[model samples]
Target: MNVFILGLGNVGKALADTLRAQGHHVEGSTTTPAKVESLAQHVDKVHVLRGDESEKLAEASQSADVLVVCVAPDVKKTRTKEEREQHYQQVLEESCKSAANACQRVIFLSSFSVYGDGGEGQEPISESTPTANHDEPSSKYYQRAENHVLASSHGCVLRFPDMYGAPGDLSFSERVKMAIDYFGGNAIFGADAPLYAIHFEDVVASVVHAINEELSGIFNVCDDDNLPASNQQVFDAICAEHGWPALTFLNQIKAPNRKISAAKIYQSGYRVKHPDPNLQYLS
Candidate 1:
C-alpha cells in the first residue's frame, strides 16, 4: 500500500513510520525543506510543499492509496484575527480540494476544540455531539476543514484530544512552564475541571486502528477514561514533586472542563493502546 501523508509533523511522522514498518510504502509532505531530512527517515519519499500548493500536491499524491491529512495551522504567523482565519480556511480548503481530486480515500485528523469546551452540558463529548465552535475562528475552521474531507465518499475523520509527548508539544514539562508563565504558577480554570487528553502513542495507535478496520464517519479518539483528572490535579502533582508552588486554581479563564468519550472507537474494534492518560502524561 502507498500511503501519502500531507503533513510530516509529530502525528504525521508517527503514522507514516508505523505504516512503513508494517510493510507499506509511505510518502509525506512537509512545509519546511529543512524538515525533509528528518521526514525522509520515516517515509520512503518526502516532499516539501505548502498544504495549498496544487502542483506539488499533484506530484506528492501520485499513486496514493490513502491520503491522511495532518496539517495544523500556524496561527502565530498571522498578525490579525481575520488574517489568521483566512489563512487557515484557505489552506484547508485547498488541501481538501487536492485530497478529493488526488486520492482514492482520505483520512483527516481533527482536534477536540471543535466541541467548544463541551458547552454547558456536564456529559462527556462524543462523536454524536454537535460541534459548538461556529462563532470563533480558531475553533470553527475545524468544521470547515472536516467538511472538506467528509465530502469525499471514502473519507474518515478522527477527532483527538490534546496530543502530548512530541517535541515542542505541550507535554507536562511545558505545562509546568505554562503554569508559571501563563497562569502565574496558577490555574485560570477551576482546579477540579476535567482535562480530556491523550498520549501521542495512543493517538498513533488509534489512527492505525481506524485505518486497519477501514472505519469511516466521525470518531472521538480519547483515552479510555471518559473523565480524567483535572488540570490542577495533574499539574499540582508535578508542581509538588518539583517543590514549585502549587498553582492556585481560580475561575479566571473559561475553557473546556468536561469528560470526552471514546466509546465509539472501542465499539468499532478499535482499542487505544494507552487507555489511561495518567500512565503517560506524567512522563
Candidate 2:
C-alpha cells in the first residue's frame, strides 16, 4: 500500500514509522525543512511542505492508496480569534481539502474537542453523538476538517482525546508545570472536565485498522471503560506532589467531559492495547 502522511509531527511520525515497518510504501511531509533529514530515516520519502500547499500535497501523494491528514494548529500563533481561524483554515480545512482531492481513501486525525462537554450528561460519546456547536477554535475547525474528509465515500475520521504514551509527549506533571509557569494558570481547558486520553500506540493501531479494513465514517478512539480522572484531580495532585501551585483553568470546555466510546471501532475488530490509562490515582 502506498500511504502519504501529511504533517510529520509526533502522531504522523509514529504512524509513518509503523506503516513503513509493516512493509507499506510510506511518504510523509513536514512543514519544517530542518526536520526532513531525521524524518527521512523513517519513511520512504519526505516532503517539506505546509498543509495549505495543495500542489505540493497532490504531487507528493501521487499514486498513494491512502492520505492521512494529521496537521496540528500552531498554538502560539492562535492567541486571538482571527489568528485561530486563519491557522485552522490553513492547517485543518485546507489540508483536508487537498487530501480529499489527492486520494480516494482519506483518514483524518481529529480530536475529541469536537464533542464539547458532550452536553450536560455523563453519557459516553459515541460516533453518533452530535458534535457540539461551540465557538471554540478547535471545535469549529476540527468539524470543518472532518466535513471535508467525510464528504468523500472512503473518508474516515478517527477522533482521539489528549494523547500520551509517546516518545515526544510530555508527562502529565510536566504539562501542569508548564501550564503554571508558562501560561500563568490560564489553561485553555476547564479544570473539572474529565481528562479522557488515548495512548499514541492505540492511535497508530486505529489508523492502521481503518486503512486495512477499509473502514469509513467517524470512530472515537479512546479508553472509555475506566472512570476518567478530571484535569483538576490530576493536575492538582501533580502540583501538590511537586509542591507547586495549582494550575488555573479558563473554564473553557474544549473537549468532551463525558467518556468517549470506542465500541464502534472495537466492533470493527480494532483492539485497543492500552485500555487502562493506568494513572488511576495521581497522588
Candidate 3:
C-alpha cells in the first residue's frame, strides 16, 4: 500500500518508517523544507507542505492509498482562547477536505484529551465514552477535529494516549528532566491517577493494521495494560532506570483519570506487539 503521512513529527515519522520497512511505498509531508532531507531517509518520498494548504495537501492525498493526519497544535503557547481555537479549526477543515477528495482511507491522529475531566470516578473509557465540551480550549479543538474525521467516509480516528518509548527524542524521561529542573523534583499526581501510555512501535503497528484492514470508525490506540501509575511511580521508574534520586511529592494532585480500553481495536483482529508498559523502558 502507498501511504502518505501528513505531519512528519515524532509519531508521524515513526509510522512512515514502519510502513516502508514492511515493503510499502511511504511518503511523508513536513511543514519545513529542512525536515524533508531527514524524512526522505525513511520514506519513499517527502513533501514540504503545511496542513492548512488544501491544494498541496489534496495533491499529496491523491497519490496515496491511505492518508494519515498526525498534526498536533501547540497547546502551551500563550495565545487568546479565540486564537488557539482558530488554529486547530483551520487545520482540521483543510486536512479533512483534502483527504476526502483524494483518499479512500483516512486515519486522523486524535488525543484522549477529548474525554474532558473524567472526574471523581474510575471508569474504563471506551470509544463510546460520552464527552463534554468544557471551557478548556484544547479539549474543544480536538473534539472538533475528531468529529470532522468521524463524519468523513472511510475515516478512522485513532485516539492516542500519552505515547512514550525508546526513540529517545521525545520520551517521558526528557519531559521529566525538564520538570525536575524547573520544579526541583518530579511532578506529582494522585496515587490513583492513571498514566495511560503506548509504546512508539505499537502505535505504528496499530496504524498499519488499520490501513491494511480499511477499518473505519473511532478506535483507542493504547497499550492493553492501561496502568494508572501515579506521578511518583513514573519518577521512580525513571530514577531506577537512569540511577537518580527518588522524587518527593509536594501535594496530592487530582487529575482526570481514564482507563482507555483497546478492546475495540483488538476485536478488529489487530494484535498489539507491546501490551506491557514496562517493556517501553527496556528500549
Instruction: Give the whole-model CA lDDT for all candidates, comma-separated.
Output: 0.74, 0.83, 0.70
**What is candidate 2's local distance difference test score?**
0.83
Give one digit per residue, the lDDT tens place, for model 3 in 1-283. 7888888887788887778888889888888887777788878888888877878878876768788987777533414567656776766656665665566677887777677645445667777877654555556666766666677678899887667774654567766675566557645343344566677777778888888888899998776554556555666788778876766654332334656677899889875666655445545
How many backbone overlaps does candidate 3 show?
1
Those runs of model 1 whose alpha carbons end farther than 4 Å from true positions after fitting are 74-87, 90-94, 120-122, 167-170, 182-193, 236-256, 275-283
Enumerate residue pairs that collide in model 2: none
TM-score of 3: 0.78
Shift in Å, residue 226, candidate 1: 4.5
For each candidate, give its TM-score against the true structure: 0.82, 0.93, 0.78
Runs in model 3 with CA error above 4 Å? Answer: 74-98, 101-104, 119-123, 180-192, 232-256, 275-283
Cα miss at 22, model 3 (Å)? 3.4
Number of the top-ranking candidate, with TM-score as the measure: 2
Top candidate on lDDT is 2
Cα displacement (angstroms), candidate 2, residue 217, comes to 0.4
Per-residue lDDT, model 1, residue 202, is 81
Considering lDDT, which of the candidate structures 2 and 3 is the better prediction for this target? 2
> Candidate 2, TM-score vs. the true structure?
0.93
